[model samples]
Target: MKLKSFAIFGTFLCTSRVTLAKSAVLDQTSLIYEFPNNTWVENIAARNNGELLLSIVGTPQLFTIDPSAPSPRQPVLIHEFTDSLDVFGIAEYQTDRFAVLTGNFSFETGDLGLGSWAVWSVDLNGVKISIVNEEPTLSSTPKVAKIADIPPAQILDGLSLLSQKQQTLLIGDLSAGVIYRLDIESGDVATVLNETFTAAVPIPHFAPSGVGGLHVRNGELFFSNVGQQKLFKVPIDEDGTPSGPVTVVASGLSTLDGYDDFTFDCAGNIFVTTGGGNSIEMICRW
Candidate 1:
């Protein structure tokens, strides 16, 4: 099944295909898994063997779940960051190596603790952990490595692999409204893009967030402005620098909430998750 047709709302995971019609319709919908109430799952990443890595904000834990498992299977605990208050973005940099973002965040106030963010590397190299049936037996737990501490980032929401050979990752800073390039090998961070398209709307008594979701595809950097409810893409070089102007892919996604995380399909369809809206919206590019 194509992962682009899947979306997770709250703690429940569901899949639906978008067909060509006057109005978009979701078909083949099924719930893969569901967590307890208020278990805010922030981000998700897929493993090579089809297991899913879930990042939770409130619990500040990382979990692995098997989508192909029988209904109502419990997700296995991968690793929990004890010191962090929240886990936000996750991206598979290499084959089984995932880069995860963790920090202190306030769900009630929408505030991120300054100077309290870090990047981590979760390497699942040669490790076997059972997902279904009985209790999970971890012969060897996955290696967890701290890559770097990001002190200046306010709201780092999205992570994407910029270059595998360069060992770099692209991070979306929601508060800063810029895309940052992080050198995993050197622990260096640089702003690659800063424009009005990424700026958040100023609202009183609320922590504004702009850039939310990010992905690199077809030599272009695709990102979402959550505050603006727009999706855009721009051609970029190998070093994560913009090579062309930003072009809007979709807009006005407002349905009582803003956009959060998203993914692209092989057929060029974009699937977006609405944070509080409890719905998944799809944009088909024919």
Candidate 2:
């Protein structure tokens, strides 16, 4: 139960040094998952076979956990949502493509919803070839391709895979806390990072709703601000284009709710997940 010891709201000010915890240091082989129907799992991706990808919220479906397969599988729904659908972000782009962001609007949208905001691709047999921007009504067959239409954007709750010398594709804009960049083979989109990280430390307010998931360790690119509990380390510029400023490491970690996504390990350690206090929080490098 270490997520800095759960429940906190010390104002949420903003930057200061940081230190206020009750729990944080877990390593049960460092794996935890509980965001199936318990709702609010937002986004998480890593499936070049490393397996562990999810995006859950009020059902629709798309969850997989193959911690090596020997026995950690019971979380496979893949992608299933019909009526007024919503599948905010999921990644695994290349070698057949898999990057989604279906929207009907929420984070803001009026009448009947269905406010689409797409950037697609699908072919692990799900077929839907190159669908970009708009146009997608559950392909699964025609192979789908090149369709553009964006704006009225609501949620694209995080997706990261930028650094293979900048293959570019990093999106997470939990309603304006912004961070966009896309080029998954040239669908073209921009806006690297925005702002919204309050939690100063016992006074600031909003902050922790964004700066969502976008893990890219080793070449650097990790984000979190779940309302300013803060955690950034962006640095990728050999042409990967993200040149300068951003290196907070970690901060007070306010209230720790369904804190969205994160991943990293190859000797740096950091694995976060807490649909607002369900579990999974392991940070290292002391």
Candidate 3:
């Protein structure tokens, strides 16, 4: 395991025995629902019914997975989005604020702007539902619009909401080497970290690697190290800056778009949806 420092409440402190180890051999890699080959699942948000609110490339699908039942669960297709979206980050915010980022792609110039991007929102629960796992049918066709255009630079993975610190939306731009914070109400966007996220904590050049997936718990920022396959806990200060020394929470992840979005179940088991692995992989601390 890599040696790293531990921080408390966003302040750098002493060291700990945190290992950059595999979170756990994925115990559950069950299939929720699989669409066509063009049906590449980019981001997934778990619902209360063991179902998933999923986003496919250039489209959207809502499907369910019964861990108790089987693999290749023949994802029940729900909604097919034909908006002007290219598809990327996605998240469910309470009963009202469901959000996602329409990937930054230039149909004309093909130049992915370093700042070209947009945000869309709709009522997550308010959307019509047909199956516990089937994609939610739109009650009135969910409203889609461009909020803040992201400067595209081969932007890899991202998240719509990461924390509750006054509604700050965190997004990670992989190749552009950027982390942005967006204002939920005003639709303003700003970069959060100006440093390399995937680059090892002590590495000098290349500033590590691109950011893939990030999740916020309480106030600590928990993110998967796609460049490193390690899980890290970046504690925040009173100002919410990722100031404290970072702790290697889990490690040994395959550095091949190894992860996207992850969260802890009520039982405290850390679960992550692996990218290439096509499985809902996870680790637990009991």
Runs of candidate 1 with Cα error greater than 4 angstroms are 1-25, 131-133, 203-206, 255-257
Model 2 TM-score is 0.28
Model 1, residue 184: distance off in Å is 0.8
TM-score of each: 0.88, 0.28, 0.67
Off by over 4 Å in 2: 1-17, 23-37, 41-86, 89-100, 103-157, 160-212, 215-220, 223-234, 238-286
Sorted by lDDT, highest first, which candidate order results? 1, 3, 2
lDDT-wise, the better of 1 and 2 is: 1
- Measured on C-alpha atoms, candidate 2 has an lDDT of 0.53
Task: Give, for candidate 1, the lowest lDDT window spanning 10 residues.
Answer: 1-10
User: Which 10-residue window in model 2 sums to the lowest lDDT?
Assistant: 4-13
TM-score of 1: 0.88
User: Which of the two candidates, 2 or 3, achieves a greater TM-score against the reference?
Assistant: 3
Candidate 1 lDDT, 35-108, residue by residue in tens: 66667777888888877888887667998877776655567888999988889899988889999999887766
**Count of backbone clashes, every candidate in sequence:** 0, 23, 16
Residue 135, model 2: Cα distance from true site in angstroms: 33
Q: lDDT of each structure? A: 0.79, 0.53, 0.53
Give candidate 1's error at residue 279 in angstroms: 1.6
> Distance (Å) between predicted and true CA of 206, model 1?
4.8
